[model samples]
Target chain A: MKPAPFAYAKARSVEDAIALLAQHGEGAKLLAGGQSLIATLNMRLSAPRILIDLNGIAGLNSITLKGGEVEIGAMTRHAEIERSDVIRKHAPLIAMAMPHIAHPAIRNRGTIGGSIAFADPAAELPACLLALGGLVEIAGPKGKRTVKADDYFKGLYETAIGACDMLTGIRLPAAPAASRYGFAELSRRHGDYAVAGLAASATFASGKLTKVRLAFFGVDLTPVRAKAAEMALAGGDLDKAVAALASDLDPPDDIQENGAVKKHLAGVLLRRVVQQLTETRA
Target chain B: MNEMCDISLTVNGERVSERVEARKSLVDFLRDDLTLTGSHVGCEHGVCGACTVRVNGEIVRGCLMLAVQCDGASVETIEGVSDSGEIADLQEAFQKRNALQCGFCTPGMLLTAQDLLSNDQTPSRDHIREHISGNYCRCTGYHAIVDAVESVAQARKGSRK
Candidate 1:
């Protein structure tokens, strides 16, 4: 199906992109990898009048490590991020979840910033970023500002990013020593959007669980951080803590499953993550 | 509204410059404008890998990309996977193993497999399955499809001294 007609503007730099967006306002859309936007456009679900292409922008494709945090450029492709040794060593959860994102073809073109900006609740990267306490760097016509992962996501396919703002990069804190990562999702098939998914990171300090971050996707309007569950496991044993965490979660219903079923699956998966963490620590 | 956008792209190792609409998809530009129909458009959405093509050495869905988005990129379709007019090992294996029935999914499957084999010469059965998971086939149930890829991996390993 042919997409609705739109104006194409090639952005030479971050400032140019922001200016084009500001000029077009809500009628303008930034084209990064175009994995999500193009699809929505072809379906006529979104009809932006001007597409500000950011492919020509320099330095937006870099993946660098500095200040004890991994700063990934918004244009960095999923395949590149998946294959980065630095990302693997420092952010293994993102690496582990990369393959589960669509397939090799999509990963080759899909960008981390594009995924986050698209804000699909079912996508693995956003939930993984939330679990790692990441931050998004945005460039606007006025200036730049950073948004924390916890506060960035607003709702289904919605983010705090304004129409005149472009997500330039994302910063992920390095995982602490003794951190055990677990990512699990249930999809009808490989490359299919997950029906239900969970990503978890648990940090142990001196034989005690010091911090636990649990995030779930495909179960709510946004990739939700299970704060209640995190509180339940703050200073408890893995098994007992996961049990309490399970009781604290209330998953929503969707086309995949009913609310009761999702809640049950969330409990079962949380138990699996805790069990895996226990074994890794043991 | 009547102005045409000038797009310059290297397709299948050949440089081509064409005037296209701002909203024209890369798949349309390849199949209709540039006359490279190797990249098929199946679902017209990102879900189906039938429109898969390699842009700047990375496999991407052509249906989910604008022609202008690829202004300065290099694209490779199934036709470019082989230069000597001989079927590549993966393609030969697919035929030998009867991996294709209707053949509509062959081009996309071949392109996807090429991407996988380029990265992992010795992919496990599970790895191969994960590689082509995005390209769905309505026929054959994927048993022979996986076997075909495994056959190539085995042959490639055997030839590596």
Candidate 2:
């Protein structure tokens, strides 16, 4: 299928890309990896007047670790993130979820920023970022500003980013000492979008839960943080916490499964995560 | 008005320059413009892997990429995987094992399998399944496909010794 006619502009640098975006305004769409945007275009779902390709932009594909935090360029491909030694050591949850993405071929061309920008509720990275309390940096005509993951996602296929803004990079906080993380997703087949996915991180201090963050995808319009579940588990027996956390979440009904079924799966997965973290500490 | 963009790409290790509509997909450019018809377009959308090709050393869905986007990039279609008309070991294994009956999904399957084998020379059955999950086959039910990959892996392992 042929996409609607559009103008093509390749930016030589990040600044050049931003300038082109600013000049073209709402009709402009940044092309990063072109995994999602191109698909949307082919389906005639998105008919932008101009495409600002960022592939020529330098320095946006880097993965760097400094000051105990892992900073990943927004243009970094999912394949690169999955294979990064730094991500494996510092952000295992991201690594764990990377393989569950569409497929090796899609991951090879899909960029983290592009996925985050698309903000598909069923995608793993947004929920994983929320669980890790990641920060996103955006650049626009007014320069750059940072938004927390909790505030970045607005709804399904929605984000706080404006059309004129470009996401530069994401910053994941360093893994806490004695921390255990788990990522689990239920799908009909490998590479299928998750029916329901969970990313959990727990920090233990002196054999007690110091901090716990639970995020879920495909259960809501956006990647929900599962705040009620987190509060239920705080400072309690891991087993007891799991049961309470399960009851706290309100999973939605869909063709994949009924609300009740997903809720039950959430409970089962919450228990698994809690038990896995506890066993790791033990 | 439709805009034309000049795209210079090294496709299958040969330089090709063409002026294409900005919305022209790389799959169409390869099949229609350059006349390298090895890559098939199955799902037009990114769901099916029939249009899969290697762009700058990474496998991507050619149907989902604009030809203008491939400017200065290198692409490898199924045609470039072998020099002779003879198939690669994986392709040969697929033929011998009867992995493909209709052959509509063969090119994409072969490209996707090449991606997996290039990354992990000896992927397990589960790994092979996971890697090729994006490439769907209506015929052969995947058992033969899995067997074909296993045979290729075994042969590659033996040759490495």
Candidate 3:
């Protein structure tokens, strides 16, 4: 399968890319790492009239720490994040999830921004971002603005980014003193899309769990927070938390498995992650 | 008519210039234009690593990348690496171990295995399997391929010591 013919424009700057997006309007797609976009193009699932290549843009591939946040460039490759000492030290959850994104070959070219922008319900980054309370930086004709991860993901393959807005970068708060994280995904193969997954971040205070955020992916239209399960966990009722998943998740039947099976597997992952978080403290 | 872009890039250490359609994948350009058929195209998509190649020193799915994207980049295919003897030992090990049956997946497998050995010459059997998991081989069932890679790694390590 070959991609349909399209005009390509390499943008030298974010502004240049934004201008191209504005000019092409709905007929253009921004090429980040091209891992997902290119596949869709080859499958004839999507055919944009113009491709605005953002690879030539500088300053969009750096990882930096400012104040108490780890700011990662949208164009930063997954391989870079896997090796970044800053991410490992400051945002361990993102670091923990990097190797699971894809294979080494794909990781070398897949971008963090592209993953988040695509907002695939089965992708790990969006769920991790939700669990970390991260912020997505967006740039458009009106300039730049930040959207909370909770608000950033709109639905399956949808995000807060508009037609002409570019996802510039992501800012995640550095892990706090008592923060602990747990991440796991179940897939047929190591590199295949997950059937079900969970990314959890919580803090234990005075023998009580607080600020628990459990984001589940591949279980809904978007990476969703299991609010009821989170409350149950924070309140020290593990059994209730397990049962609360019923109220929290309603996964649709997908290619990998049925909704009930995915829900059961998700519960299994939740138990494992909860054990990981609690056992570390013990 | 498809739009074309003029690009100049180094393939297998030789500098060449060509005009390609904006949508032409790097694998197609190499096989159809440059006549470098070592890198086979299996799935045309990124799932099958049959189109794996090195771009700027990192292995990437050739089918997932546009040729125009490599205008100023350096690309190394199986032919380039094989001709230069870069993966000579790996190739010999594959042959000696009978790691391939159909040979369709050999080019991509060698490239992937070489990439792993280059990173960590002492990779464990599990690590080797994981590293090459992206590259699918329907013929050998992967046991022999893993054996071949492991043999080379051990040989390289022993020699280094």
Best by DockQ: 1
lDDT of 3 by residue, A122-147 (tens): 99999999999999999999999999
* Model 2 segments more than 4 A misplaced: A205-207, A237-248, B84-87
Q: Which one is best on TM-score?
A: 3
Model 3, runs deviating above 4 Å: none
- Report model 3's interface C-alpha RMSD after superposition on the true interface residues: 2.0
Clashes in model 1: which pairs?
Answer: none
DockQ of model 2, rounded to 2 decimals: 0.67
> What local lDDT score does residue B25 receive in model 2, on the 0 to 100 scale?
91
* Per-residue C-alpha lDDT of model 1 across residues B18-53, encoded as one tens digit per residue: 999998998899999878787888988888788888
lDDT of 2 at A30: 90
Report the candidate with higher lDDT, 1 versus 3: 3
lDDT of 1 by residue, A1-282 (tens): 677888888899999888877777888888988888888899999998888888788899888888889999999989899889989988888887887898777887889999999989889999998988899999887799999998999978889898788999999987667887888888899878878788988786565555688888888888888777777667674456556645665667888788777776777778777666556443
Docking class of 1: medium
lDDT by residue for model 3 (B1-161), tens: 23799999999999989999999999999999999998999998788899999999999999999999999999999999999999999999999999999999899999999999999979999999999999999999999999999999999999998
CAPRI grade of model 3: medium
